[model samples]
Target: MTASHELRLITLYAICARLFFITLIVSASLLPPFDSSHKTILPAADPRSLFDVFVGSLLRWDEFYFADASRNGYQYEHEWAFFPGPSWARRLVRSVWSTGGRRTISSLSEALFTGALTNCLTVWSARILYLISVECTGSASVARISALLSLLPSSPAVIFHVGYTEPLFNLCSYMGMLNCMNAKWAQASFYFMLANSFRSNGVLLAGFFLWGLIADPFLRKQKIPLLNCLKSILYAAITIAPFVYHQFTAWVTFCQDDGLSVEWCKRFPPLIYSHVQATYWNVGFLRYWTPSQIPNFLICSPPLLLLFWSSTDVISRLFRSHTQSGLAKQASMVLPHMVPHAIHAFVLTSWILVAAHTQIILRLASSMPFLYWSAARLILEQPKLGAWWVGWSVTWGCISSILWAVFLPPA
Candidate 1:
């Protein structure tokens, strides 16, 4: 089938599958949660109404924080852990649907409005990812397969049904990569900046700008030009501007009022994101390596392993000659364009493993299209293992939706 045909089919499948998954989660949310006593800002007790069952089902765990931020700005220090992109985006989207004269009326609830925005963004992201895969792999078949596999993400709840950052993040990240592939450096930097506004790790996306405008030419034995060097720095800085601005805002808000009283403000380059993650979430290097968190480690291992394997498989093949006519010859497919993405996945996976919350890889992994490529590769080369991967994604995605509804661990 053509790419357009595949996108239409994917759109249908995504809607149906997302509805099914939400049905299960909402059904479970109708029941009492597994633990009604979640620490750190979870709403106590079960959702009390039909509307609550639908919206509140997905609003468990950290979503409570997002819901709060949607109604209110970043008033609390811990609320700074979440970027303002989703909240701000939701407000913009809701305004489009607002009615009654001066457009002061909200036609929808916060959860409903956010879901409408994300549902469209996610389906559109699927198509963008398909195009990017085609650009990266030079094969419609690989792109189609990768796009299909991406529908069954390890964290379906975050992608389709929630007020989470990842849906917008995925769209922007894919757009940035696609723009970079097309040599649209300015547009690429803009999209990456939008991505960083959603997730703090989005600052790492500047590597794509650096790689495309700078590193790629150096690797090809081209003499470096001063113009390219200046362009690379400018674009990469644009991509990272959101993160730097985010920290600067926090400093302005907190440090100005209390200054040295805030412990994080006392340090050099006092970033509230880093401080909150470390102090509130215990997310420093090896801080999450406790025996009590073993289950979370196991839960997140599949994607982590897949990500590492995918990057290393491409990177290792870089050193080998591909003139021989066999698998070795095929190993170098789109190697140059993929170099940045593979490195991105590898470095980001390592960062998640060592320093960040390991379980978050399930949600964050979807932002990197390379993960789907790796899964596609497995299905093509090792059908048995790929079947297992598919089974695990479907099964665990359903289970996680339930866990989210009930407010269980691995948050």
Candidate 2:
């Protein structure tokens, strides 16, 4: 089959695979002792009907927070921890079908709609990921593998079709990366802004943009005027303006509480979000270190190791290679490309190492496309083991989804 045909087939297969996995999670939720009492946010009581079991099963840990916050607005202090992006996006989406302009909807229905929207976004993300991999590696098979692995039973996969920010975040950030790969700086900046609105890590894309300008020979050769360069920098700052605006919102909220004086409020950086994260969730670099969190740390270590290993290997080649021809030259050319991946992986891994909830690394790591790219490369190098790799990946993904559905550990 032609490459385009192959890509289409893979896209179809990914959609089917996602559907099958979601069905399994729904089935698992209907089994014995299927309790919904443990849910923190979504309205799940006894699954008196099939609808309750299916809808209730999907609203796990963070979904409740998003759903409740979207439906009610940030009513409590802890609610401030969530970025306004996903919650507002969910409401905006739900409003499209509303008879009038109403954004409010029942919590359960909102959860279901948001979950479905997330799944759709994930499918689109897989398509973009496939295109990026093909563009970068010139190997359609590797690109296919990368896209498939992204949808495999990774923790992020569980959130792919759930009511979470990842699907939207992935779509926007991957789009930004794709634009960067094409050297469309302006378009990339737009998507990067959308991404930052969804998650704080969206700011990381700024590094990607800077690296492209510095490393890409074609960009450098253009030797654009200084005024245009400054304009580009100004646009990039504008893209991140939403985040700066949110900090102002947080500061205003803090000031209204009256616990802090006006002088301190003016002096303090937007400590509201950081305070909530540290106090309510025990989140900070290395602040969560304890013997109890060892299992989570261990569970998340493999991906971390793979990312860092790939990054180190690439960096070593860039530094140590002396040859100016053939494979060494090709590696040297790719070295600049690897710069973004190394930086992204290191910063994310550092967050996990310093933070208490290492389990979150599974979800947060979804934004780092290099991880999937590395997995695809490994599969390509071991062609004979590809089948086994796919099997293990899909099976593990299903197991993880089941665990998530049942509200089990290591979510």
Candidate 3:
């Protein structure tokens, strides 16, 4: 809060941001060269392998199906069955890029570009998270610490450098959170929608915004008029429209292909479905048997534990101060707003646990920014304890990173 403190925080943020960028550049340089021979026509029936399947789906879009009938002269199927609209857009982009006679960038270049974009988004998201904490708690220290923790060089940074979707999702989610806190409902809805499109987990933004609106003292005092609320809801609906369109297209394609209604459950084999069902039934099951999967489980467990512990502390604090000062009254007034955001976080976390395959570690890493912010706040309240806690977290994070790199499978 002091001038000196503000200066120190700003300095810390700048240094961290610079270091993050440097780390990204160095890591990208260490990656293997992109295989030029890997390039081929869109949708090669059985497409060389899984990596090809993913690249073709991402870059060519028209190759997202299993049939070859739709392919005009291409060896692979042009079945634009699932999410056809996006495929058309992708095709257009590729056509234009080709016509320009620009050499196709290698896969390594593509990966690096994506990684750079993701890291930039991560920085932006960290700033937004910092802003939200400042707005909600009115503590500059909280904001600074939250931003720093969000950028920790662990799973999040690693995922960003690998062309994963987590960084982009984090950016949109945090932007939505910031907009919601500021009572910019339309903007919040737009960002939330973008986040959801990238990953279904982004629907959590809707819940977070709703809570912020209801809890905000200004909004509660008629800052958000009925007309504004209606407009916000409409904006949210518009944003969600694309997802609806995608699902509809997918369904129509499926129906046309099968000549009958498609059953979602029947799509997956019975054995795999049964395994997933069992996992869902057992919340704390340690039944992962694969050597590769064990590390993932270990990496994911610490964050869940931290989330649980922080939630308990928050609840306890809320109750302990319930009968005291005007702060209590303010908190009581705000509790309703907090409820929805809390619930949304819980739902998103649970969904990650249940729906995720072995990749749950990476999937849930996006939520670490928010969770770490919460944990940081709890620790900040107790100076000595906070210092100890942060020290341990940093130490463990470093150890984990080294162990992960050492055990990583050879490329």
Taking the candidates one at a time, how many backbone clashes does each contain?
A: 0, 4, 0
Per-residue lDDT of candidate 1, residues 180-295 (tens digit): 99999999999999999999889899898778777767655578888888988998899888888889999998899658798999999799999999888888999888998898
Model 3 clash count equals 0
Best-matching candidate per lDDT: 1
Query: What ranking of all candidate models by lDDT puts the best one first?
Result: 1, 2, 3
Model 3 TM-score, 2 decimals: 0.64
Error of 1 at 8 (Å): 1.6
Error of 2 at 286 (Å): 1.7
Superior by TM-score: candidate 1 or candidate 2: 1
For candidate 2, lDDT tens digit of each residue in 1-411? 587786687679779977887788888777653445534444446666777777777777777777777777888888877888977797786677585875556666677777787788888888888887777766677777788788773454578878788888888888888888888888989988888888876766777755666434333345655655665576568567667766678777668778466443555474666777777888877876788777777777667676777767665665555333322354522444555677777777776677647767777777777778777666766565555646656666777778877777566
Model 3: how far is 131 from its true place, Å?
1.6
Over the stretch 149-219, how does candidate 3's per-residue lDDT look in tens digits? 66553342344433344666677777777777677877878877766665544545665544554444343
What local lDDT score does residue 89 receive in model 1, on the 0 to 100 scale?
Answer: 76
lDDT of 1: 0.79
Query: In model 1, where do residues sit more than 4 Å from their true spots?
Result: 35-52, 97-108, 156-159, 321-334
